[model samples]
Target: MGRQEKVTTSLAGTVGEEIGAFLAPVDAALERDYPGDPGTRQPVHTVYVPGDVFGAGTVRSWGDRALAALDEHAPDAAAFAAVLGLDGALAEAVYARVRTKLEREPVEDLRVDFEDGYGSRPDAEEDAAAARAARLIAQAYEDGTAAPYMGIRMKCLEAAVRDRGIRTLDVFLSGLAEAGGLPDGLVLTLPKVTYPEQVTAMVRLLEAFEKARGLAPGRIGFEIQIETSQAVLAADGTATVARLIRAAEGRATGLHYGTFDYSACLGVSAAHQASDHPAADHAKAVMQVAAAGTGVRLSDGSTNVLPVGPTGQVHDAWRLHYGLTRRALARAYYQGWDMHPGHLPTRYAAVFAFYREGFERTAARLARYVHRVGGDVMDEPATAKALSGHLLRGLDCGALDLAEVTGATGLTRAELDGLATPRRGGGAT
Candidate 1:
């Protein structure tokens, strides 16, 4: 069999066995203790926050000032747009108009991403400064004053580092380690990851580090940024992403869409295209398909065009634009990202609305399915198999919660235990 066929065959067998085993119940006590409601478990959405948002000088003060500004304007659409790197005048006008009706809603996770080559590129002085900046940010988290969960993006491995025969990547990661234990979880955003071997190589280095630090072997997790054209066009793109996730195994956390880079790879003009552009949607779909249900989370890229317009019209335009993108992401099951405080309310509003809507629809479907598949114990393997997969998916997406799902579906905790099992079949569900 060819590689694709081989992969397909292997996946089918694996998924089938897993489903069968998972449906079989565990000890009654174990079922009660598991936190997942199966029916009502919603996907967690992580929001990405840019590291460089705090101005270049006097980092703490800059951060404080930015926070203050966000506090004042986050609820206002225009103000939020302005803080998101949009023009100032226009952002203010929008803030004035939308400030009254907004509420405070913040997601749990916030990611701080480093600029390209902060660690990997040449320039001794520049790299040192970058290291210092990273340390400062990590220190902020260590102080326990930042978000509850925080993550950092590391530089991707580059050709120059490879050519020099210097373990530049190692040196950079070492600096981060010295700064502090990994930040909540490290998001090693690998760019241009075209092959599985690249992921394995990074994994080897992480393993070495884990041993040196006496940390558990699989403690560090990663989030791959599928940016390059080559990565998207790879013969086994989904499989490649899966391999990357497996490299981290217990450590793999999530995957992020790189809108600009992926667009560039497609030979599409990057100018004026927002993160929610049609091209971006296509890219996100590919990523979603690749990450369907192995439990690894997925994130959509940022809206590049910060909304900056005078009058409520400008701010409204910006909100509508961002709202569309936010809607798209929530539709695809992504959580959150690095947004200005001003944008927080919108992010919260959009995400909450999406989940509320999804839950309602999914709940109905699962309720119907359970009723259709009544409790009669069956002997036919194929008939049992089809019903099992359908029920499992319904439970996974919060369609069935403990109280409602268990009572209505007649699927005991024992039957739901297998829902978390990784299926080699597809991506994040």
Candidate 2:
């Protein structure tokens, strides 16, 4: 008998009874199969402007002046559109004006300006301020025509906000809920996440808010900014990340690599270092490995330094800035923040390169694995040893166009199918 028949006959008696019982439940599951159609994948780049960008202070003033200048210089909608289209030198000028205005406001003022003076909701004014802040955030979403995935960096939940008690957490979440339904796929940037319990507390608060709103449980998501030494130095960094992921459970969507905070944690003195500093890269690798296949996106923190001057090789400066940005993107992380419009192209290019390379590499490896192994299993350890070479070869070549690679390599559909299937051994067959 052939191998298939031999195996079937060996299981024909007692095993057949177990198989029949298993098949009985199988039909019920098959009948209710809800094989949903695959949805289109959205583009991954998200440009973040500080939430304070539109509050009633220097940021708001700068925005008003910039808008007025745009109106005066380019009155028509087309001119307005042209200004929006500005990048490199022209874009830098507009961004600088806005940045200057935003920087003028003391960080203390911005923090205190939040409704209710941190934790205490003394009266109606605080409530009104909270409502206004929420409205401004919503309006910014509408005005900027921001990417579908938007997030805000809020003041940390702390002793001041907590009133030296746990009630502060509830008050802040309540304020957010009262302001509006959680922003689309909310990402609360929790600064100074030192312990797992802190993450758990935030999750509990989000859960309470969702239940009260009658929203689906776990609808809100969060991303932690890993800025503290304690966060990075936790016993088994991987375990720490895994713990954070579990705390948010269904709600955690991303983990942002906080370069500046991390450097400070390490006591690095150099101020001009970029996000890709060797030390930062090592920390990010830990995050990337932990987050792999979790469906939780990873983002590198922003390039803190912005280019100065309105003219003279501004594009070159932007390119250099982008080169750092691209390195982050190439590392297989999905998102990064753009502090200015000039950084937009770099973000886009890096994203395009990542997807293009990842798809091509996966495809090519599958193609070659099928060619070598055919439909049979490699049983001998010695025979199985060199099979990894095929995968490494494809990865080494970087990205390629799927159609072109398939055509050039002459791999057939049946072989491709075998390659796609997992083998008994861990590596692709």
Candidate 3:
């Protein structure tokens, strides 16, 4: 035989020290179907309210108001379903379910903002608001309607506003502790983060609060808001999402994008600033890439085009919100901010329809792939993950039942349960 050329690859040249350590955990995370806590139910949208009007009963009140508005504005599920391109029969089912879901529990997460939502206020007023918020927290727990996820959004740590932000946070935390300590699933949101030091400082402050308030260590976590060009890219043109999260020192649970503010940073005009804007897409893409397997959640910004004002515009606005919500879903951005109560209907509609419209078809395909059936069908690990993701997401959010998923996927209950989980230590099926 003729002599063959020798082929050798240099591992060090291919992957440096940093890449190796990063990949180690990433590979382990990928072995599972989903990263982070699968039991953690990520709300479809976060409802933001100003600080003054926020009280323990606020969420319940909002649910009632939202339901009333939904009935008046979007009474028929069939109509909204048509707007989303859902099948007539399936659309009705989703509509009916969503109506009940909203009536029962409308807000999954609430943010009492001391930032733009509340605007500037006197210290006494701010303190009063904080106390009210604390009472609300306690009330929510007692009533059993407290959202599974809830938090307060303080103003940025900028020099001018940092003191007020700190004061508000301190007052709120103190009141919350005095009332009944921090509740489960509570987080503090730090917005417009431009430097890693901001995160480090906030973490230190939280630690101090935990100690003073007699709360468990690390009981409070914060979500970073990526709203500036600086957040998307450092001065050296490197992505800063991972750095920002690391600066949190293990307390950063989620990173949320702010659409209008981010767009303004890019100098995009008001008319051009949108959820699907190129600049917004690029920034969020950087966030997704950096935070991919780290288990730090990512949320897209809100759509400012609200469904209020005129009768004609309301319908147009609803359709626009759904389109934007669907756009986020397509990019795997499951969570976004809903600025208005009206946005709630479209948010749930888009999410339910996304999972429901193709539930049976996707499940059947997955079943075929899992069973190794051949009929011009092809599947990969990613395909399995996608199918499992929908089923699990639906289940977690109350959109799909175990029976429905099992029946559709043709898998036993045990196998069905594991569908959403990453198939670890097993050969590819």
Candidate 4:
């Protein structure tokens, strides 16, 4: 027999060069920011305060105010406890937990708003407001009361407000520089971004500010708020979220959804505008796909419904906010905006409940997979990553304790910690 032809099945290249080339920068950017292993504390929610009202003691005051409001709104703790599924004692304890969390980190992230939060004022008034915000920010830093993530939200890059936005940013940053330096994790929120050029221009301005202040380049990160249809879809009808991130050129760290603004842009009536609306769902889906594995964090928008009632009973609104928070969590958008203090209780309730409810099952699956035991269900590496991520998020968010997680996962605290660092590859497509 003729020499048997040696079987030669050469593998094709690992991936198309064009695809690799396209992904190279995004991969690099992901490594640069690496949202999963945030070096700093990541706030569960951000609280926006008007420019003139923001300052050092503001966080503490806000917490105190929130507690007071909670007391008045939920005069019957038992009733509120029933709603949260906590017994009287446990309910009080959870209430205490909320109070403590608020007092300790009332605002994990703060936005000194110069846009909607700070209504249009005269130019001189705006300037003064910016200066006041700067002083307050500096004072908060000095007092160590500032949230881990803190910054200003300037008006949009629309032609009408472009100059004003730039001026506001420059003034606040300049004032911050004069005072000392920007706070750690400081970032600006550029709202209603509709084009890549807008983000690019903002990045250039941020770079200039960094250079002018003698700070390190790329230190001034900004988050893009996708509120308009144009923001998500390019003129050519392609998804623009990735392009928007690229436009930041390493200065972008997050993409936050703006519910009301987005709904309005889509012509949804105020009555129909909501976080759970299909339009919001579509926008969030685009954001997830665009930012996933790119290191740009995603945040859902706030509900306009405040947890307050004319009779000072906030049970109904509290329930609504809790449901909304749970919906966001279900969608895997862990972060959202908090418009009122009453929203705090429901936020924690939903997040903690999610972690706790899944902990046992997730732990069992992880343990079985790790031990190579038969459990009727096979677990893959992705499963391991997901379990680790869920537990780690719970830990990071103050929802689950290290001890509880360690016991459940059959892993040492250190081992679990290792898993917490976002796995490098094989993420969801």
Candidate 5:
């Protein structure tokens, strides 16, 4: 044959250059605003305690109380499993892991409440509580007893409490600076945000705090609590959540659903207020889409029905809470709220069970995809990233052991992460 063509092309070189030039800004925006997940270890749940009740040993106390609840109600793996309908074979493994998780790390994330939980207080009292919260959290971190993430949820940015909210945040961060240094995991929750401007105001306030404290720019980040209809949909009929995220200017860590507040706002009856309520689902569904590819995480709201009272009553509540948690996990809302210490056991149980149940299948698929081996179901790059991500989340939350995943997949943690992150060339993608 005559000399085979060494190269194949359709468009002229100038056409390609012109096209690239035209799309350069679009690429810049994608890289800047939609950089994807930060590959960080996200906590499984957030525990909100009133500012006055939070102390240096609150985390440990919660763990002890949760363990005590288990001892009192469900004395064994079989008993505990019966309440939640866990598989007979998987019950022991899930129960043991839950106990171990409770003993080792009961609360992964904590938020000292100053809004609804703490309620409106006198300025002096609120300021003192805010300052004390900082001191106690600082000591916890110093003593190596702090949760992985801890922060405060100041009052809303409404016109009435705007100044007070700003003051509390300043006092808190300023106190942290005095007490040594702020922890890297320090976060804030802005509650009852009704408009994107409120989010922008939070960004401005953080910028001011950074300048005042001589901290690096953008050092503070906050979660926007979606509790109002206006926050989900604007008067103009636009999805306001997407705009709210943009207003954060790269400082929104998560969009947390406020179950009760949001439900009540939608005129849902008190008895029907729940995270799984249709109203709540619609709100969070909007949030999920708005946050996708924006590096912003989504947190489902909590159930007000706590696990407490007599054994029978506690069992009912546990079943409800556990079922709700499991359902939320199936929908991909990994993080949630824990309102009571009794809720801790079931929360961990649901999470561990979800991950452990799928561990083998996910590992097999990920391995096959990585090795380019034939399989009954063809896997794609996106699916590979998701499979690897599931394993990583499990590993992060102590649901699955590193060695166990490694054994199943024949891949190390770093290799798994490489597979989870897409690259333009010569990588997982």
Candidate 6:
């Protein structure tokens, strides 16, 4: 055999060390600012209930109501498939899981609204409602009937409601603390955040609560609601939404796009205002970029064209909701807002179908990537990670079964998770 050629270097080793030293801060910044997805179960939807109306049975009641909607309108898998134009192969899987999901766990994330959905209540009334919400939610968690995540959407940080928002937040958190400490899935949302200062204020407020309550620092995290035109673009023409995420100081869990309020801000007529609007798309696109790799999830807003009224109207509304949910999923916005109980049937239907339809193709691609084999579509590490992530999300939202993903991909849960997780500095090793 011929001797291996000796490697040669033109530069000294010190040159490499100097380059590393120069880029150390940049590396640290990337690590700090863009930590990637938290690898937690990001819920498919967040259901908002007015504070005055939310009760202990809200979760179960919503489930039952959604199931009833299905029983009335969809009736069966074939009916729903026809309504949403779902492929025949996906009908049974989507239908059975939607039914099972509604029966078992309908609302994955619940937000007790003290903001728009709640409107303005008298100070005393609002205070009592906040406390009541905390008590009820804590009890629900204790009873094992709680959604995976629960919290309040407090009023904005505007001058008129600044004090009210803070007071409500304190009352809710204090109430939970007094009841039996915070639950594992506790969430808080600071709504209508138009400036980075608002985010910093929330961080400070949470810090104060931690200090006062003797809790660990940074134990409380909250979502920043992006619902204003100013939040998407600033006076100086920079992306303020990105600044908002940074201002959260590592405590922001998600960025929720608000449909109605944001549309109204831009003078988008009510008739034309919807989650699929061009204005909403532009704003969410900015949000998607701002939140990318920040470990902050993005949630598309809800639609006011709710599924209600007569059978014909309900069917139309269901189709719209299902299409919107599926559209958001395609755009990589994994979570969304659901305002009406009637919307639940279609929400699950869309999510389940998306996962089911792509199951075979995605599985084959991942298998080929793992085995280093040839296929029509060449898959790389990033593509494999995305494939695994899609499967995990499907499993998380009950859209796809674990046994099926593993059986098809020939990959274990741990292996899938490792691929789904983003490695430092990204790209293939």
Cα lDDT tens digits for candidate 1, 325-417:
456654654543434443444443344333333443344444444456433343233333334434443444332345655664466655644
Candidate 2 displacement at residue 157 in angstroms: 3.2
C-alpha TM-scores of all predictions: 0.59, 0.58, 0.87, 0.86, 0.97, 0.98
TM-score of candidate 6 to 2 decimals: 0.98
**What ranges in model 6 sit over 4 Å off?**
426-429
In the predicted model 3, the residue pairs found to clash are 32-422, 33-422, 56-136
User: 176-213, model 3: which lDDT tens digit per residue?
Assistant: 78887778768789999999999999999999998887
Off by over 4 Å in 1: 1-108, 117-138, 161-180, 183-185, 235-243, 246-250, 339-341, 356-429
TM-score of 1: 0.59
Cα displacement (angstroms), candidate 3, residue 138, comes to: 1.9
Shift in Å, residue 360, candidate 1 = 7.3
Best by TM-score: 6
Position 113, candidate 3: lDDT:
89
After superposing all C-alphas onto the true structure, candidate 1 shows an RMSD in angstroms of: 11.7
Residue 358: error of model 4 in Å?
A: 2.0
Native RMSD of candidate 4 (Å): 4.6
Clash statistics: count for each candidate: 22, 0, 3, 0, 0, 0
Off by over 4 Å in 2: 1-5, 8-48, 55-130, 137-146, 160-180, 183-185, 235-238, 353-429
User: What stretches of model 3 exceed 4 Å from their correct place?
Assistant: 1-39, 82-85, 369-376, 410-429
For 186-257, candidate 2 gives per-residue lDDT tens digits of 345565576778788778777777788788886876767676666655766445766676566556666777
- Consecutive 10-residue window with the lowest summed lDDT within model 6: 420-429
